[model samples]
Target: MLRTLTRQSPLFTSSVRGFKTSAAAFVKAGDSVPSLTLHENSPGNTVDLAEETKTGKYVIIGVPGAYSPACSASHVPGYISRGGELAAKGVDGVFVVAVNDSFVTKAWGAELTQGKDSKVPVRFIADHAGDFATKWDVLFDASKFFGNKRSKRYAAVVENGKVQNAWIEPDSTGLDVSTAEKVVGQL
Candidate 1:
């Protein structure tokens, strides 16, 4: 029974079967962000990226998963700590996106925002189905560790729905290029 259920799971099925695409198709500077609805705490409470970025500058941080070591310890913290600095640079909001369920993402947000009076307005977004990551062409097979597809670590500065700058980590899981300090400096 367990074997049957495991085989039927989407992650198992997709990873086992496989999909292919051109690596050159990833989002880049000058490209308009794809329209998608990401969930914050629940699917009912959705954030529409197209509408959100229609007016001001937004920094989108894409991570492989929520609560991962690098993501929890450094990536998200850097952005949270530098939220004021980023805001001063004309950023309207910093969105941390991860390929996890809304519940997990929300819990992670709470963990990061704990004890903060006026918490850094960073939004934690859940790309549960990987639709947003797929559209951005940042979705990569992470089945070995995560059992499903995950986003390549990256950061993008969007102005009025179009990308003004993009920094994708050379090694999808590295913390070099997509760090908050590096991305904010590019902004």
Candidate 2:
């Protein structure tokens, strides 16, 4: 007879099952994106993914935090600093996404683009409670971050509503795998 497993072991079977369930909805390369409308911070105008990706190359960048050390110093700034170069290579639009509110996203976008004079302006978009993150499979339980959730550091290059490339960090939070330089290189 097979012995029934209990929660006595160091590892919980339920935890493993939950992990598998959570990992199943992730978006991957060659997968078409779902239709969603995201707004630009200032204008508050809804941008439809179906429409945006139909005409040009758009890059969706996900950040764990807006002003964190790695993100502020390198991840976002790296893209803002080199927006032109990326644009020149046929990138039509660049968007930064986070699990913050619309207001915070607006402020961060303005701050990031200040004094850059970049032709390819980066739009900081609020995922608003990780709805977008959940859809993209990038949401993390970052209670330490802000007593709530946050997005993973990853980048997806979309063309015509289809993912041309997806660079996701294995560790959930880090600058090692995902960066503008690396993502742009894929384009």
Positional deviation of residue 164's Cα in model 1 after best superposition, in angstroms: 0.5
| Most TM-score-accurate candidate | 1
- The true-structure Cα RMSD of candidate 2 reads 5.1
Give me candidate 1's TM-score against the actual structure. Answer: 0.85
Q: Against the unseen true structure, what C-alpha lDDT does each candidate score? A: 0.87, 0.77
- How many Å off is the CA of 50 in candidate 2? 3.3
- Encode model 2's per-residue lDDT on 1-187: one tens digit a residue: 1234455555545644443333445568787766676666644666656666776787888998887878788888888877887888888878888877777788887877788865685788877767778888888888986688888888888887888888888888888767888777767
Residue range 1-187, candidate 1, lDDT tens digits: 9899888887667635566766467779888878888898988999888888888888999999998999999998998888888878888888889999999999999998787532337889999999999998899999997999999999999999999888888778899999998987877
TM-score, per-candidate, Cα-based: 0.85, 0.82
- lDDT over C-alpha atoms for residue 76 of model 2: 86
Best by lDDT: 1
User: Which pairs of residues have clashing backbones in candidate 2?
Assistant: none
